[model samples]
Target: MDAPAERLQAADAELQEIDERIAEIGRQNLDAVADAYKEFSAVLDRYEDRATDRDDFQGYIEFREQMAEVLGSIPDDLPHRDAFTEADDELTTGVTSVLKHANFDRARSQLEPAREYAELRSREQDVQGTYRDARSALQKEQSTLETERNELERLKRLGEADLDAPVSLLREPIEAYNDAVAEAFDSFTHAASARAVLDLVAETTAYPLVEYRPPPENLHEYVHESAVGEESLSRLLDLAGYSSSKLDHYVENPQAFRSNVATNQSYLSGLSATPLQVSWPPVASDALGWHMRERIAVVGRFATDEVVALARAVRDLGLRDDYERLRTSATARESLSETDRTRLRAGEIERDLTTHRASLDSVREILATYPPLGRR
Candidate 1:
């Protein structure tokens, strides 16, 4: 090859080498994070499975003690005991630690933009200070004018590099790794287990509906940052659901609590489909206003402007049959009491026929405008 061509080839190879290095770092970090989540999910599944109704009263500790005994010695087929030991430790604290801090992650996302701007601003200030010092030195010696000029240029480049640090080679790889770790934790920390547990509690307690469980602390802060987050599941639960009173109530009602936890286990294990989450049928029309007044209040909590927005979205999507079904069912059953999960109005009521008729019309009109849905 000609000299110039060979030189170009060498430069290309060097650039390729740098690219490969970055790619390798990306792969390594992604794999590390993925493995952490995989292991966490596995450990959680094992604990939940092992802790049966018999051990329900003992809580999660019973499952952990069982794991300790079984994993005490590495099996002959396994590579090493150290892996098992590490996994045991991870099950005990590592997974929980990651989840406990998961909510803070939302808050941290807001802080990131501020953090980057602050760093850039500080770098700008340093550049200005350096330039001033260089100008002062030039006043002290005419011969140093050229030196100061070069120093200012160097400071300019340094400031550029400092402000552009996030895009720098080293910084890029580090940030990629941080993101991989964050996503890793995010995958498992969604409280799939916790959600299931809460559902089970509701089912086992035989309460057709109850307040939802809360997210881990700080996780809920992402809500209210924007209008969308305001309607998020966590925010809704925090706003309208039962408080920390459930924790105390669990002690007073062990059998019921156990049922709740057990039901959660069942729900998590059952299926991937979203189990009828929202309460429906608009509290059976509440013609008397006093009958199922509590149910009416509960429905009011979930049926909000957000629900209206969602109806608009579905209509926009042109899910023609679905939109019709929702509007029609809500219109038809708008004011009927079937507390036994039936359609016919059955319960005793001082039905104000004229007012009840007006109330039914109101339910139909609101549903047509907002759209309503009920699974059953």
Candidate 2:
């Protein structure tokens, strides 16, 4: 068993032992002991200050009466009957005017049996608390084990890859196509109107992986409605930097351009074709095929025909039978580090995975075996 499971087991055993001891003493008998002692202790506490050393004569009288009543209330058949009698005898000093701390101390010692039974319940409660803490710790460890398993499984999958595969067969074509399209999109953004380029980006919202932040609402509206929409983005950004007097010569409303276009200078400058390009490791063939088909249409709308042809070439590559193997190898090469490769070759990862699974199972078993100690 794991450390958590072992701790749970120890706590469970201690709790069970406490329960058994409580059972042996008989719960009813122990309860009667606790009640009598509660009343017994109460009388001592109340009169300890006032009745001792003749501090108050009436308080001494009241203290003795209450002690006698407490002893009288105990059932004749109650276990350890002598302890109560002894405790009462210790308090009875014939014609004594005042009781002292020594008298109370002697009485308390005689009542040790009652205290023992009363404290048994407290001991049981303490053990139950420990069991509860152990259970919570085991549960947290189980959750951590699940996360570890997932991460290790990913590493194992990478380790199984055929590293000798000519991944460049796939990477070369995809990289070439990616470079061609990136350059083409840059040229498209420089030549096309801002409205045209942004509109094309907006259309890509239907494809999840082709991520582009949707154009700002006010900016989108400005590009679509304003006459300045016809100007290329590169030209507009250069025009936005001009002085208000110079900008007025270029556009009808200089203030309008400042609010709608110049205010969004950061957003406009950040737009790029990076999201349009495929990842180096590439997705599964079917997903890549689907993604490329959608991208082909989107890129074709604004990019050069040569760029469009390169996108088509990437889509064709995804259809090849060797693509999955090469993609897996590429993913392994890109993701795995020297330490990870060493562990994988040494079979240490597999051993670690097995150990985690066993620990998780042990904790689960301990939890199933011993539920919480509820009201008893």
Candidate 3:
């Protein structure tokens, strides 16, 4: 193959390789999102089940107590009078036992009035007074049951409150994002084609980028993310542009910048596992904190220079690939709306890339003990 053809062949291969890697990373993230959904659903189901049981038990207790009261109202001449008598104080005794354990002082106070009536009946000192006293005591007991029942109802309602609302809200937007990307990638093929997609991305003055592939600790093991504070600069210092601690040999030769596939995969895995490390949702304030944490995956954004750096590897191979440096030709400019032109010039996306430091810190606080991604 001639030199130009050889370079084209290489560009075609490298472009395909990079595109596939990025797509696979997206797939992994989507899977994570799906897993998170199942976990959320399971938690809510358990809570709802418990609440339902409590309501059912409370309803049955209320019905039984009501029937006993109706039977007691019948005259002693009725066939059911004896049955009513047997159950007369059973409900009261049960309530008393519960209150005694739950609130001993109140149970003791209520028992005093009821006990006085029983003593009066035993002594046979005017049965009329005993009747009046017993009625009074029954009224007090009813009040206590009402209060306890109402409280239980309130707690049950609170437990079943709009807990699922927030989870749904967070996931919907992310799913929409994943859907859009999937459709877009349907057309991303060779380097020349990939460059077109990058051009569309470049036009976005404000876009999200998940800063994946945190740099290796040494050339041997991956370290911090390159997009993080001072990390990008550190990457540039890696002698050969690719974040390797090794010596340069590549300022002139572009091929030195591309690292092996294995290292790239390992780094992507670690960074993708944590959403806070990426570059989107802009700033991390209370206003934005909740929604920002929901992000499952984001593509890494590149500046004009960075894109050019990658483009250089291909361009230097032989023929100049103008697509590397970001096309600002009138044709490219006209492709975007006037609003996008303004956004691009303002460097809104780049500003957002660095603005959310505090937000990321807040997330780290929660993940200390319970990792969002389980063990790994």
Candidate 4:
């Protein structure tokens, strides 16, 4: 055979081997992703079941207590009243004997209250015992649920690792895939990041593009009012170039973030209603902290040069103006005449600093997982 022909045959064989590996990796990745979804679905089902159990138990307790109260309120008939009188006489004889036999002060102290309060509290005690039993059952179920959640979480983490495993087997091909995906998403991610950065800069520069408004006092009413936050989040996501409707499904469902917002609002609402006294330092700090932590998570998952660049850009943006305003308010609070305001601001600063430090730690953790592209 000619030398050129032999060389061509050898190159073709190598290419075939690479193609086979890529195909195998792709199959494995698809399976892993499916498994992850399945595990997540199971975890959600368990959560729903536990939640239902808790709600049902609560309803049962309420119904039982109400029924007991109604029955207890019914006036006793002649026969029942005579039986009660006989039982009271028996109890009084028992207490008299105890008082004679035991230390006088101790017997009087213990028996007097029992005699005085027994009629008033017997039904209540019975109801309380029933409630306690229900609570114990619920607690046991909750423990099981917690165990399942932790196990499922571990399985989900394993699935996440598996989903990314194909990259190791088909590194070159996957790198190609990354390049293609990056090309498709680059403009969108960049624009989104740029817009976010600009917003932060504007707010900090005092040329605020958007105003920060406190959530309504009534959380349930606020949630029911409309889908404003949801719409705003969806608009932001669109602006950032998340074109895939499937990917945007969760974003469109504002109820998902509702729980998060409610929890945060509750924390903030605990401070005094006075705008100046209600320190927003925690919210500003937490928002930045969460944003940075999310970016770090993104980098850890993708571990690409592009993510590193984006993280760097985010760090450079500095704190938002609203954050600075809160900080100033917190500082001025120290000089306030009201001790409560001073204490609240101090608490807010402490919480903000703690969360900010934790966020920084989260970033460090991400860096550890996927060191910047070229670092040793």
- Candidate 2 lDDT over residue span 185-296, tens digit each: 8898899999998898888898777888888888889988888988998888898799998999888788988999999988888888888898889899999888898888
Candidate 1: global Cα-lDDT?
0.35
Q: Candidate 3 or 4, higher TM-score? A: 4
Report lDDT per candidate. 0.35, 0.85, 0.34, 0.36
Question: Model 1, 1-376: lDDT tens per residue?
Answer: 2232233334344444544643754644433433333443344455554433343546456656665555543243432334445545544553333222232233234334323333433443454444344333333333343354444343333322322122232223323333433333233224333333233333422323333343322222222232323232332333323444653442344344333432333333332212212223222222212322322333223244443333233223223334333333443343323441231132212223333444445434432432211210
Consecutive 10-residue window with the lowest summed lDDT within model 1: 367-376
Per-residue accuracy of model 3 over 77-152 as CA lDDT, tens digit each: 5322343344333334554233122222332333343333333333333333333343334344445545554543
TM-score sort, best first: 2, 4, 3, 1
TM-score of each: 0.14, 0.67, 0.18, 0.19
CA lDDT, candidate 3, residue 160: 31
| Steric clashes per prediction | 5, 0, 6, 1
Best by lDDT: 2
Model 2 CA lDDT for position 148 = 98
Model 3 pairs in collision = 214-225, 215-223, 216-222, 216-223, 217-222, 217-223
In model 3, the worst 10-residue window by lDDT is 221-230
